[model samples]
Target: MPLVSPDNSATSSDEIMRYPFDTMRTVAATILSNVSIALSEHEIAWKKAQDYVQSLPDPLQPAFMDVLNKHQQRIRDSYKWQEDFAGALFNAIDTVSNTDSNISTSFQKIDNAKFTGFGHGHLIVADE
Candidate 1:
């Protein structure tokens, strides 16, 4: 898959600041895509191996199949781990993005808030 380039001409400063988050999200998605492709390839190879093992003479078939099955399970487990890791990475990026957005919104609110002085007691109140 091709990575998409950001269109800077139409992007605001806020969007520019968020570029890193976008990049991270894209990278995480790409990692997941790669892991899926690898899993597909592994599955194809596994089927071929199984077919080959099954074609072996009766006495040898069981032993070879046993080994293949064990190794296949391990390989599948490894791929599952990779897929899980990628998913976690994507979630982390989303969390960070949300946090950043919240922070930015908070700052904007603070910047726009109007503080007013109350009567002789010298109390202050924010005028929303």
Candidate 2:
């Protein structure tokens, strides 16, 4: 899998001083967006999943949004259990299902997003 810290609390706030809640919210939103894309893409190119996913990177990504951006890059790389895709896919599924919440969302937030499946409002919104 990707190099995840065992704690998984986003412990590394290397740049958290400059970017606060906004960074977190943006990262959360982008990750959710990608999961949606990957889920849809999964059905579209189930057979060529590897090719379809590895191509996600090489696109310009902001530095503050490091989590989503790097996570995407990792998804494109190959691993025996297809760790990258599998990790993203599993996280997406878990967040959706609330199974083992690394990121948790409430129904009120879902209502806030108008149930549109975007901008769930569970993330911190700060930074530049």
Candidate 3:
């Protein structure tokens, strides 16, 4: 997992001011795409396994089918679980993106302002 902090130190105003929303979105999308590809590959492999089980000798076919059926059930359950998880994750990403956009807009306004501050004068008091 990658640490999500700013790439530059806090002292670097330019870099610190920039948000990595795009990078985060890309990473999340890439992960989801990979999961999709993996699910597709799993389906293909399962189909092959079914074919193999069908070709097994008569006495062994029943046992293989039972095992395959159980395995498929587990895959189905996992798919459902991940589907819900991905949905929630995507929603969270969207929420974060929206919030980040709002914050960045406000930051830009502050960044664009021209102002200066200083202590005009100082008075000293002595203790007796």
List TM-score per model, in order.
Answer: 0.66, 0.24, 0.53
- Model 1 agreement with the true structure over 31-73: per-residue lDDT tens digits: 7888899999998998999888888899999899888899989
Instruction: Give the winner by lDDT.
Output: 1
Worst 10 residues of 1 by lDDT: 10-19
TM-score of 1: 0.66
Off by over 4 Å in 3: 1-19, 99-128
Tens-place lDDT digits, model 3, residues 1-128: 22345755666544523345566567667667766887898899999998998888999999988988998889877876766666666777778778888988967765765544434563332222
Q: What is the C-alpha lDDT of each candidate?
A: 0.78, 0.47, 0.71
Model 1 alpha-carbon drift over 4 Å, by segment:
1-19, 114-128
Candidate 2 yields a Cα-based lDDT of 0.47
Candidate 3, residue 118: how far the Cα is off, in Å:
34
Error of 2 at 22 (Å): 0.8
Report the lDDT tens digits of candidate 2 across residue range 98-125.
5333233444454355332325555443
Residue 16 alpha-carbon offset, candidate 1, angstroms: 14
lDDT of 1: 0.78
The true-versus-predicted C-alpha distance at residue 35 of model 2, in Å, is 0.8
